[model samples]
Target chain A: MEEVKVYGAWGSPPSHRVEIALKLKGVKYEFIEEDLKNKSEELLKYNPVHKKIPVLVHNGRPIAESLVILEYIDEIWKQCPLLPTDPYDRAQTRFWAKFIAEKITPAVRDAMLIPGEDAEKKTEELIELLHILEKEIKEKKFVGGNRNKYMDIVSLYVIHWIPILQEYSSKHVLTREKFPGIYDWIDQVLLDCGDIMENLPDKNKMFDVLRVIFGPRNNYKPT
Target chain B: MEEVKVYGAWGSPPSHRVEIALKLKGVKYEFIEEDLKNKSEELLKYNPVHKKIPVLVHNGRPIAESLVILEYIDEIWKQCPLLPTDPYDRAQTRFWAKFIAEKITPAVRDAMLIPGEDAEKKTEELIELLHILEKEIKEKKFVGGNRNKYMDIVSLYVIHWIPILQEYSSKHVLTREKFPGIYDWIDQVLLDCGDIMENLPDKNKMFDVLRVIFGPRNNYKPT
Candidate 1:
């Protein structure tokens, strides 16, 4: 059997997290592009519980969820550790990673909704979230202290899709001025992961696809 | 500094999860119950982000979130290993642990809302969730593996609250008939963590506390 295979849509940050980690770890695998609009039976079969993308099939066994996939990838390949070795440090990284995963949905929701219509309150909440993100991260290369780590691969790096969110919402949530640390983390991660931007499907194309599901005025229109 | 201290609330599954883990690992720790209605200032400071209960303060440092605290306790004590030693097994346990945690809120929400309205639909969704649980845990000693493990502690084993949900919702989603292995797990964990139930506050009494927040529920008085 082939070593590793990833079932992913071109647009999802969750998929990219696994992709970048696999590339960084030099894990060889087939890449399957799942058209999320018309999801394949294979993807559905693999991840029946959530039925979502970023399903990593390794050695014929499929692991669903990006975090689950990331952990699985880290376990098999030890070339470059995505997480710190110290138990406390590992916990700290995990705490932040979990925090981001739990909070990101609400953050984006707040960013996209109409101002003053519950959306306004959410937008403020989103800024507060960004502020926390800024406080935790810095100009230092990664969220995990000066290295290209999992936290950075997921958090600081994923905001490359912000332009799409902004185009849809008509409001800029992630200007460099408000969060220089996060901003620098973004630039550094792009440099660190060569041609990472190119890996993401065209932003405008992705946003258009999601608009039917996400709503207008603050809808997602890929860059 | 004392050996270890847990700030918790009576009968809360998250806090109970921590308590069970501590008992299984044979860790002697002082339990400080925080009346969630009137939360302690100390808890606010320790878990500033969430400010919710079940904070494990070892020496001076505090760890928030039940799953995180469970891992912390396992690492600090290291006697009765709650998680598997192998990385694959550990990852699988973590995956289910997270899945359960993510859904507990939604499941509990279903049980709380007025039944027989749109709640019928929500209840079916709830049953579907339990079926997933039932399938994953089919006839096994516990969610993790052969022996009663962390997944049991963190998931259903923490509370007899399932009975409370069944009675209140009148749907009886989780039961021994449908899920015998899990029922067996319930029996084992109850044996393992003796008298923890006595430690839990009366559910009838807790209803009085929750009713104020949830607003009055007509037709069914806490008799």
Candidate 2:
């Protein structure tokens, strides 16, 4: 097998999704950590389009976009299939995955970048989107069920990114009752009934990044 | 073989995407057109989550989302391959397809939904996005390349939808100078040089729908 190299940030859901896929597939790859603020030339070279992490280089061919990377990994290794063998099921997975991917960055940007009523409005819309997400992902073990697939990768985006909203506004956009299925699903994916606190990345670190970037109430300092 | 049925909206790119996939595969299926304003119960029922069109119901199993439907169609009827056999290539195709899908909706929305500055902002962004799309899609036969794959299906979003942008805004986002590659590709897709154009629904009727819903814009005056 040719060498597989992944350029990524430590705590990004996109990066995490690729990491889990490679791990599940048992593909040996070297990881190069990137400072998003100061992007490395390798990251720039590999992913000039987005200039983001979660870029997968296999046999010197570069593929960006975490969702794209996951699909690529699934196809190459084929050890543990991330997508369903059946066409309909695979379509369902991709629909939900794309829906999830489309919502994530915008939701985060609204919370972290935008301001005023627009920010709050976008947050409300974002929460509504998450509810739709929770409703759609209520079935099976993982989003893909007993086996992890594209949906699970998308789930990481939600689980990991929402904290920034919290640190910035102290508003829990993802109220417990609102998204029980998804909240429960995350618990299942990260900490199964038999296992506790195993798969999820550190909560503190995620919050820390959010707090640093977004600040509290868009100003951070207490009046 | 179980029965195959598709519920979709006439002149919709998403709907046409699934249709193209079916046509390419030579799959036999019934097409049900739904009025977007007055959606059918069956359409709502088949896709309870999205309540949108381009739902493929195979033997009572319903799959929604045009991209998802394309994937489903390809999976079940493999005669005409919609995705590349190689994982990386497939991923690359999908990356652009997904990128195209995400941008087209918003870009069109930007051009049509608002007016003045907000609309202009969207148009500028849409132009930038179109340029990116043109550059990225420059390679291969289609987004799927050498053949119509899943990307080709999703690219219908562009074909069915882009004209609306042009018709309403009094400008073509994809012109020979700005998006020569995209202009050429769309021409190829719609001109019957490739098998893709044969299946496309009429673009004029789509303009009729937009006019009825949005009234007269910059140029075209609605009666």
Candidate 3:
């Protein structure tokens, strides 16, 4: 019997990424909800370097980082493949995934935390990034092709978390008209893919949690 | 006929990563050195998003970002596989590789750019990160098992570039005594692997170019 476990938080976008991937691959996994206010000892033990959530443990070994976990899941299960078979296509998918993870997500979060003119500047920067992504998605049905794949799975943060971020910040940059390509992708991944829709955390709960964490009164600085 | 072209710059550690991976795979390719000051139209055309070098053009399709390119090379060529065959081992390798690329490299660079008390603080932060890596490497002969592989290749930035950064900033943080495990692995990769040794950019040349770009007089902020 193969034992798989995910140590993650409910409101965390990265944690949701892990759950969605597992659900997509039809792999049975035990989800251990972690408290960001006071992280579990196992979370720290599994990921000593960063001490971040969404660490995937299979049998006994632990894998940290959502992107790394996604690849591991695809490799181990070898069914309902996330990544494309061709090397170039896989590279392109991985490229966009990395851009989404490293660039877009951070910019979105940064846009929220900052206030005033700087926030506007950051929002603009994010818009520029979204434009690049919009162009990429314009030519395809989804980032990962016909059906939701690795890139689409990686983009859950954009679909689910960005709205909460926008609501909190009150800077609506990701409007449907501005990013029609990405907007269509949003429907395809969230609505078309029942597996992903089933696995997502409640958005209002996420917004509420985020309010406590990054509310104007709190001097919240991301680590 | 498979045509592989690397658009890279000397003195750029990310660029070196692409070269090392290609050499390890015994993949024949042409190297196009880009002038970072005035980048070529081809480099911009190939990597429109970032407009950065170390873009791997395999059969006219370009892939930017060194880590992505390395994975592409490994997947396509498959000789003397850079990543391990076991799924868990591959995940561990990838986890560390991402840590190195995203966390370690940026910290190292940030440490160089900042000055005074901040630089010292950044240096300490970098040392803390190195300690984490040291613990991981203490048990291994190389990051990539017995032979120099993907993790080892990814760590070229730490082995080669940190020294330049330290020299430029005048902060000696990565001494052999401070990080013995990493030091030993560095020798194993640089000294033992003739391919890597032969392919390295001239260190002094790199120093000169970097000095022109980031010297004290120049208000050089990395984009």
TM-score of 3: 0.92
Per residue, candidate 3 scores C-alpha lDDT tens digits across A3-47 of 999999887778888888898889898999988779999999988
Better of 1 and 3 by TM-score: 3
- The global Cα lDDT (0 to 1) of model 1 is 0.71
- How would you encode candidate 2's per-residue C-alpha lDDT over A20-123 as one tens digit per residue? 78877888889998998999998988776677888999999899988778878887787878887766567767767777776656775675556566777877
Q: Model 3 Cα RMSD, Å?
A: 4.4
For this target, which candidate reaches the highest DockQ against the unseen true structure? 3
Indicate the worst ten consecutive residues by lDDT in candidate 3 chain A: A214-223
| Deviation from truth (RMSD, Å), model 2 | 4.0
Query: Model 2: per-residue lDDT, tens digit, B1-223?
Result: 6688889877667777877788888878899989888999999888876788878889997888766666667777779688878776787777777677766676777676555567778778877777667666685444445544566567666765676657665766666787777777777666642576566666566667667876656676432
Top-scoring candidate (lDDT): 3
**Predicted candidate 1 versus true structure: per-residue lDDT over B33-107, tens digit per residue:** 998879999999877667899898887767788887887777767887887776656666777777777775566
Q: What DockQ does model 2 achieve? A: 0.67
Worst 10 residues of 2 chain A by lDDT: A191-200
Looking at candidate 3, what TM-score does chain B attain? Answer: 0.88
| Cα RMSD for candidates in order | 3.8, 4.0, 4.4
TM-scores vs. true structure, each candidate: 0.84, 0.84, 0.92
The DockQ scores of all candidates, in the order shown, are: 0.43, 0.67, 0.84
Compared with the true structure, what per-residue lDDT tens digits does model 3 show for residues B155-197?
7788878876776666778989888888888887787676675
